[model samples]
Target: MASIFTKIVKGEIPCYKIAEDDNYLAFLDVNPNAKGHTLCIPKQEINKIFDMEEDHYLGLMQFSRKIAKALEKTINCKRVGVAVVGLEVPHVHVHLIPLHDMDDMRFQRKVSLAQEEFEAIAKEISKNL
Candidate 1:
């Protein structure tokens, strides 16, 4: 079965896209931690980050770095935090969160944002790219 992220990558589902390249895709999280929170994933569906081949792992990070740089420029935050908690979905993904404080990245906390707000943030981040 195709993972939800793969559906987004394949355009079976819509996404608030931030950026993309040949091997990776970056888009806003539908349920975001912060205003500019984004999800970065490989185009290829790998169950675990460590399971990816050496070249794919290296390329994914490099691709994510570009998105993170643009996200930092567009969002107001102390820093951008990266997290990988792959249990929620079967596919490998990295969460790029705009961190104003340590608590901004907490998984235990509930976070919510409207779709329109996510779209606006996605556009803002896209503009910086």
Candidate 2:
């Protein structure tokens, strides 16, 4: 069975996409920690970050760094925060969050956005990429 992220990669699930390449995808988190919180993941589903090949893992980071830079350009924040806690979903994901304070990266607080807001934010971030 495919994971939710794999379904998104396949277009079986819809996403507010920020960017994509042959190996990876970046998109807005529906349940976001901050307004511009994004998830970057391998196109191929890998359950654990460390379980990926060294090259594959490094490639994901490189891919994520590109998205993080774009996020910094598109969102107002003190800085962008990176997190990799794979327990939430089976697929490996890098969380790139726009941080104003320490609480923004905690995952305990979340923001709600309308569908139109999500689309606009995704478009703006893609433009920065």
Candidate 3:
């Protein structure tokens, strides 16, 4: 079965895309932790981060770092925070969150955005990239 991220990559589903290269994809999280919360994933569906080959793992990090820097440039936040908990989905994903304080990184709190807001945020982040 294709993971949800794979579905997004294959265009089986829609995403508010922020960035992409041949091996990676970045998109805004629909259920976000902050206004610019995003998820970066490998185009290849790997179940665990550590399971990825060294170069592939580094590639994802490199891709994610680019997105995070763009997020910092585009969003009004102290800094961008990163999280990697692949519990819910079978595929690997890196969470890039715009953090105002300690609570912003916590998964307990979430923010909802309208479709327009998601599209705007994604576009702004992509512009900064």
Candidate 4:
């Protein structure tokens, strides 16, 4: 079965896209931790980040770095925090969160945003790319 990220990448599901390349995709999290919170994933569906081949792994980070740099410039935060908690979905993904403080990255906290708000944030990040 295709993972949800794959569905988003393929346009089976709608996403607030931030950036993309031939090998990777970056989009905003609908249920975001912060205004510009985004998820970066490889076009290939690998179950674990470590399971990816060396070149793919390196490409993924390089791809993500581009998005992170844009996120830092666009979002109101000190830094963009990276996190990988693979259990939520079967596909490998990295979370790029705009961190104003330590609590901004907490996975246990509940965060919510309207679809329009997410779309606006996505547009802002995309413009910075």
Candidate 5:
């Protein structure tokens, strides 16, 4: 079965995209932690981050670092935080969140954004990218 992130990558579902290259895709999280929270994933589905080949794993990090830089440029938060907890989804994903404080990193809190807001945030991040 394909993961939801896989569906987004294959265009089976829509996403507010921030950046994409042949190997990776970055998009705004619909249910965000802080505004501008984005998910960076490999185009190839891998169940675990450590399971990825060394080069591929490094590629994802390099790819994510680019998105995080863009997020920092686009958002007003103190800095961007990185998280990787594959429990919620089968595919590997790197979470880049705009953090205002410690709570931003906690999964307990969720932020809701309208479609327009998601689109705008995606655009701003992409522009920075």
Candidate 6:
């Protein structure tokens, strides 16, 4: 079975896309810690971040930095925080969260947004990228 991220990459599942390239994809996290929280992942569907090749790992970081910068410009926050906890899903995903304070980085709390809002924010971040 394919991971959910792979399904999203293959178009089986829908996503509020932020950016994409031949190797990577960025999109808004449906259940976000903040309004501009986004996930950056390699389309290859590797289960763990360290298992990726060095170049592949760096590429993810580079792509994630671009998304983080765009998120900083598109969303209101002090800075963008990064987290890479792979337990929830068996895919290498980098979480780019818009941080107002320390608690925003904690996954204990979450923010809800309407579909239209997700679309609009995705568009804004895409525009910035």
Q: Can you write out model 5's per-residue Cα lDDT over 62-87, one digit (the tens) per residue?
A: 99999999999999999999999999
TM-score to true structure, per model: 0.95, 0.98, 0.98, 0.95, 0.99, 0.99
Which ranges of candidate 2 are over 4 A from the true structure?
A: none
What candidate 5 gets wrong by more than 4 Å, as runs, is none
Q: Candidate 2 lDDT (Cα, whole model)?
A: 0.96
* Ten residues in sequence with the least summed lDDT for candidate 2: 42-51
**Which digits, one per residue and each the tens of the lDDT, describe model 6 over residues 15-120?**
9999999999999999999998999999998999999999999999999999999999999899999999999989999999999999998998999999999999
lDDT of 4 by residue, 1-129 (tens): 999999998999989998889999999887777778899999899999999999999999998999999998888889999999899999999999999888889975547888888888888888988
Order of candidate numbers by lDDT, starting with the best: 6, 2, 5, 3, 1, 4
**Measured by TM-score, how close is model 1 to the native structure?**
0.95
Q: Which regions of candidate 3 deviate over 4 angstroms? A: none
Q: In model 1, what are the clashing residue pairs, if there are any? A: none
Per-residue lDDT over 1-129 for candidate 3, one digit per residue giving the tens place of the 0 to 100 score = 999999999999999999899999999988888999999999999999999999999999999999999999999999999999999899999999999999999888999889999999999999999
> Model 6: residues >4 Å from true position, as ranges?
none
Where does candidate 6 have its weakest 10-residue lDDT segment? Answer: 100-109
Across 1-129, the per-residue lDDT of candidate 2 in tens digits comes to: 799999999999999999999999999999999999999999988999999999989999999999999999999999999999999899999999999999998999999999999999999999998
